[model samples]
Target chain A: MKKLLDIIVRIFRFIFFIFYYLKELVLSSLFIAYDIITPKDLMKPGIVEVPVDLKNDTAIIAFANLISMTPGSLSMDMNPEKTKIYIHAMYLHDKQEFVDKIKNELEKKIHQIFE
Target chain B: MIDWIAAFFLIAGSLFMLVAAIGVVKLSDVYMRMHAITKAASLGAILMLVAVSLLYVQWIVWIEALMVVVFVILTAPIASHMIAKAAHKTNMPKGPNYVMDELEGVDTDIPDKA
Candidate 1:
């Protein structure tokens, strides 16, 4: 029964991965398109650390990669001991909001996909 | 038509940038600040870069923009990881609002003192 459940979960995860990748591709393409047309120097890039709740390394790595692939940010560091991520961002406003965004949005998706 | 597109890109990018900056200022902890910097800033940059590419219509410029994107994609996470690790080693405090700590009590080995 446990093996059967594992198989089913794996299949579901595979399907989810496909969908996630597709979404990521579309979003990245759109971001690239947007990058091609605008003119302004409004970016205030900096590195900031994001605390992580998830314990798995694979999940953490995936989360970092996902953030990097997104438009305005890159995941620059991962402190394994601290369980935190350092990200270099071209834009930032409310740090707590950003943290919450990652925890609630990006990390949540990652946990669903990887867990 | 082109001008309008450029304007839109500029405005959108600026908005993203502004929001990212605000996040850095408003967030209470280092972890939260990192989140603001990575997501909003990356999106803002992509928007701004796209706008520039549209205006220039030059292959080299577009390629350069792509390179920047690539660099950002590659570096941001690595940096984040390093910083987080450093914080952990230094025993940085987690936010009070955090509810659960999955890493707690996972290992029982003691470190050898030099």
Candidate 2:
């Protein structure tokens, strides 16, 4: 009975995380479309390497995939050591802010879902 | 009310598709363009499928749309990831103003493929 409750809680958390991310994702994608559509010099595309704290392979892949799916970001490659993930961002204004989102928000949620 | 609802959805779906197409062309490079194509195209496809499913309101049609959404959600990321990796390996050029290559100096033993 305890195990069943635990499983239920995890599934609920996972679903909630998906919905939360989906809402943010859709809104941002819409905004990104505008940036692309404009004639203004609004985009600064760059490849950034973000250090990874999550050791699990599943978590790493999920994080990378989510980064790719998010507006204006694409996961390029993880180094041979898997210590850092290289990503291309349409707007490369702040590296620390993006990495913080990956570490604190995305990776934290992924850890909750998986382990 | 139903007519209005369906019309709204159809319009929304078409707008997304149009944006995706324009983005693919206007965006600078392969990876950036991939970001535009996969994200916009998949979202557009989902919205369009949902509008169609709502229109038909048939059991099989609804089920088929549900399946399509699931399939798209599952595969789009995988496709984007693989393509990015391949592009990286092939030394595909990024946009001119694009800055930084985090993978620049990292040595990798992964062999190039035929």
Range of the 10 consecutive residues with the lowest summed lDDT in candidate 2 chain B: B102-111
Candidate closest to the true structure, highest TM-score: 2
Candidate number of the best DockQ: 2
Clashes by residue pair, model 2: none
**What local lDDT does model 2 show for residue B85?**
82
Clashes (candidate 1): 60
Per-residue lDDT tens digits of candidate 2, residues A49-99?
Answer: 787777788777777767776667877777767777777778778878877
Provide the RMSD of all predictions against the true structure, rounded to 1 decimal. 10.3, 2.5
Backbone N/Cα/C clashes per model: 60, 0
Q: Could you tell me every candidate's TM-score relative to the true structure? A: 0.53, 0.89
Tell me the docking grade of candidate 2: medium
Q: Candidate 1: lDDT of B9?
A: 94
Candidate 1 lDDT, tens digit per residue, B44-79? 787888899989998899999999877765566566
